[model samples]
Target: MTSVVPVLNDSMVAGYLERFITEELHSSGFTEASIAVSGGLDSAVVLKLACDALGTAHVHPVFLPYKASSEESRRDAGAIVSACGLAWTELDITAMADAYVALEPGIDRLRTGNLLARLRMAVIFDQSKKEHSLVIGTSNKSELLVGYSTWYGDMACAMMPIGDLYKTQVRSLAAFMGVPQQIIEKPPSADLWTGQTDEAEIGVTYDTLDQVLFLLVDQRLSPEEVAQQGFEAGVVRAVERKIVSSQFKRVLPPIAKTSQRTVATDFLYPRDWCT
Candidate 1:
């Protein structure tokens, strides 16, 4: 059978997202956008969209790299920034990260990676403040659904233009937008450590993961039903588990109700609400 995931019309998606970036920023009373570019496909797509929507002068792209970050990352990041006609800006987080890493001698790669991500998050927000821009997140649907990202770390952002698009779809849009072939083709990684790829950590390739996600989430198929679609039951269940577990990353923190109206529950106001 053909792939269960739908192929996107790149041109249409591009136009819609460009408008999305523009309207989202304008609605929030902001005219500038700040992005954390990882030299990866998602960020490349977001950066390009922001530039198209608001112009190069209005979009500020910054590269935040840890000491162990790949040289390839730096090179690809530079290429995309130059392609967008924006001046290259990067900040090294090694010193900031290592300062805390030294406190805990036995901290493993997982903790260290989270530290780096949060550090990058802190820096990006500061940079956004310095430039008076809103932070545009680069996470795709696959990572967000599977809980593959660090919460309040890489996930913290003013808005996510590609948050709804899956990894496979993002790749298609990236190609259409003429993002560098090397960045699009590179194995997806957070670059937390040497030779680490997202697939290796997630235990599934995006091609398969995205298909399973479409069936289970978008199609709303039961685990058994998805398994019947020629997918291994084990993989189906694993994806379901991820979606269930990572759900916290998708929404606001829960509040224990003591009063009649509680923040984030009943006292919520629209994001664009004017006082």
Candidate 2:
């Protein structure tokens, strides 16, 4: 069995950005694209893409940090913004999470993390509304598949350029686009908890996970075929289980049975009525 690491070549990245800003940005009547810039590789790549797509002037990077999130993340987030010569602002969400936690002391850190994710989106969406822009998403396909992201939290977006790429592919594109090597090499995380790493939580490396996902999702491999491709049986089982259990996260909430063509969202919309 062979392992193929997925990649989005430099030209593909550039083309996506070009397609995004020209087709989405200008068409949306947005003067800017607002991003919730986390101090992580995914967001960094999104930022770089935004810069290339819309220029620094039209790409606004907003950093929203929770109290428990590391200061290193904060610094890293700011540094990338500065390095790219783009404008950014800080919105400390410590108070917001604290207020929610105060109301429900039993709330777990995951809850707070989701809250932070939603809050950041709220900020980005609001800014997009004000600036006549749209909220760009940073979620890669790897995270999206396993429901690793917040529901309406990090998942909210006017468009996602990298959501189709695996985590490894995201790194490839970011590196090719001249993103800092530090960012490209950093351990991936959602920064939901102190000392949290994505692989540690997910129990599998992105390389392995991406291979499984690509085989399963793209190639439509069966469980047996997937396991035969060099993945641990347990890893394949776990990934399959997560995918089944988390289908709701990837889609709209279940609506009650209704008459035909009910607007409970039987419609598949591209989010815009285009020209």
Candidate 3:
């Protein structure tokens, strides 16, 4: 059967995203970008795009690794940095994360993972401040839709160049942009813990998940209709549930409207709004 997700014109997509990064940064009165490169496919692609958009010197890539993060992650992250013609910037979050982890005894993997992600977020923002650059996010549409990302952690960013692309599409784009093959072919992982992979946590491969997401979200098909298209009913419903449950991650938090105008409500303004 034909794939539900349309194959992207990688050259066009790359050119468009490069333009997007340049325009978004300039609009905000910034000329540089910082990204947290986790030795994963998404970050690798985003890093490449940023370097291409803003020049190697203008884009800073930092690898933030926890104690349990795999060595492969570190190596792959370094490879991408070299490929983009940038110097290596590494910050180990183990000490900081463990200091907090010690306070809460018996913290499960889930909570510890979140702590690590948020710590990385904090460090990356600080690094961006030091570099006077915006933090470019690496989240793709698949993670954003299914709520697979850490809230306020990996999701925190000034701009997301590849936010609209699905995970499968990201791989394709990565390949087209000459991202390291090992990074592109490896199983997707948050690297929160040793031997953990994204597909294992999401309970489905990206190939399956992206198709379901395209049918439900892009095609505007109901769950029932998606299942009719040869997708498993359970998988379709699970994907739908994730999209619904993770809606909060996709938007700004709501504020009570006691007055006529409130932040993110009636007082909405563009990021580049000037008085």
How many residue pairs collide in each prediction?
A: 0, 0, 0
Q: Is candidate 2 or candidate 3 better by TM-score?
A: 3
Q: Which runs in model 1 stand beyond 4 Å of their true positions?
A: none
Superposition error at 143 for model 3 (Å):
0.3
Q: Please list the C-alpha lDDT of all candidates, in the order they appear.
A: 0.93, 0.83, 0.93
TM-score of each: 0.98, 0.93, 0.98
Every model: Cα RMSD to truth: 0.9, 1.9, 0.9
Model 2 C-alpha lDDT per residue in residues 1-275, reported as the tens digit of each score: 34575555678667766677557777767768888988899899888888877788888888988877887788778778987898787888888768878999789877778888888888888877877778889999899999898899899998888888899888878778777777788898888888999999999999899999998899999988988877788999899998888899887677775766645466555656676
* lDDT, candidate 3, 65-181, per-residue tens: 887889899899999999988986789998998899889999999999888889999999999999999999999999999999999999999998999999999999999999999
Q: Please rank every candidate by lDDT, starting with the best.
A: 3, 1, 2
Over 4 Å off, model 2: 264-270
Clashes of 1: 0
**Please, what are the lDDT tens digits per residue for candidate 1 over residues 56-84?**
98999989989899999999998899899
